[model samples]
Target: MNQTAPATLRSRLWWPSAAALTIAAAALGATLLLPRLFSDPVGVDPYVLRLTGVAIALAFVALVWSRFATVRPILLAVAAMTAAFSVFAGGPQWIENISGSRFDFNTQVLFASAAEALLTAVVAVLAVRTSPSTLRPLLRLRRFGPTALIATIVGVAVFVAVVMLLPATLLGREGIAPVALARDLPLQGPASVLQSFAQELQFRGLILGALDRVAPPWAANLGQAAFFGLAHIAVVYQGPGAAFVPVTIVLGFVLGWVTQRTGSLWPAIVIHAVADIAVTVGVIPGLYGY
Candidate 1:
């Protein structure tokens, strides 16, 4: 008998979905915790880290496929996110090498972000050939309605409030230089916008969308938010690094909740972009570029 999936898994969403939360959490630790623990002189290569993350996620998917169907989509989404992040992280080095390191920091970041967004879209689009359902659920690229527009407006207001409320101690800025800030804005602005959109799609659309299908809304939200927060681990080298990870996790949760409510990812995308622009402009640069 070609028995189908148990109606138990489909009819109600609470148990399986809640269980999936723990799975996602474990997956996050497997993929990121090791790297964080070894963040010092024991520098793990980015390529190796990316490969290990995806391999671990997919291996978990394989292990649980027979036992826990509800988490399969969540695992796949994590794998996809890992792959895309790896590409984004490594993209700039290739760009710099090819272009002879001639581009400024902002320009290099712009190219890296663009490559990430485009490659993810292209690969997903092509994968549709083998499985038509593969691309749509994983990427909520078509969800922009009135509610999303309202959310976007709110996002801008929230951005302004955050910038105003942030203390000088956090920014470490004694005095502002209007001239240098203006000079960097042209490239920095677009770079931040593109980078924000790229990440929003990865965490909110790609991963959260997949989880939403398998888990309850709250579980799905938490799953993606955790992944999103953990994904910013590199920022430890870029900004106040370690402290920023928890903040990004919170940001990821709010954005996921916004998407869960408004049914669109643009609100998250807009707010993220404005926030990035704020961080780059306000915070002083560190060893790694913001």
Candidate 2:
């Protein structure tokens, strides 16, 4: 069967993309109305609002892009980037966030891996079986094969270096804590490594791919990066009037752009994941108290 769209399932497959789009819009709407939903709010965090808002906007845009005929490549790309970000940049924080009373990187890695597998499966099914027009995206790859691979490596390297060199102050109070891996998380070493790799594939590779085709590099970068940061909503908390939202959005935009310009997610994924790992490992023992 042609991978673009299987003839038999074309009619029924429209719902997936449509559903995805709807979910995106609903998410956006909720963010706008969050104030009304919560009464006597303990403490409103602007970052929470920021994340919810961008998720909705991006989902809406993705839906609109689905209506086109020539955007399949871009859609694939977006999916890839989103998936990657969820794992690398977003996963470690997610681990920290949901740990609540019981925290372990091994557990977090397992949960994250499972989620990624599910997402990849969903996208794969849609890509192969859905109406190409229904699920298409707005970006396309100008080049592929070896060049893409090279770009991915170089991009990931540069991003990692930049993040490493970034002053600790840039992360802000409600921002991501600095962490990198020294000993690797317990028995899950192989699994953790794979999770990091998968993250780059989804976010930098997939999501950026779609956005790049539709908007200018800046726009695409900003759009996807916002989603990228928002995806970390589970991790950070901010006060009602705090500027967390704007900061996260700005950070997301920068990371997303870096991935797009390099034509690969590797750059964003490596730095993003490594940064988290470093933070997780805590300050080096030799430097200070750690």
> Residue 34 lDDT in model 2?
68
In TM-score terms, candidate 2 sits at 0.49
In candidate 1, position 228 carries an lDDT of 75
lDDT of 1 by residue, 48-159 (tens): 3645475455636634566644444444445555566666677677778889869876688778778767765654453322322421344556779999999889878986
lDDT of 2 by residue, 94-158 (tens): 77876764856666666666566456545644543442443343222233445456655665576
Looking at candidate 2, the ten consecutive residues that score lowest on lDDT are 281-290
Task: Let me know the TM-score candidate 1 reaches against the reference structure.
Answer: 0.77
User: TM-score for every candidate vs. truth?
Assistant: 0.77, 0.49
Q: What is the lDDT, from 0 to 100, of the residue 222 in candidate 1?
A: 84
- Candidate 1's C-alpha runs over 4 A off are 1-7, 11-42, 47-72, 123-138, 234-239, 284-290
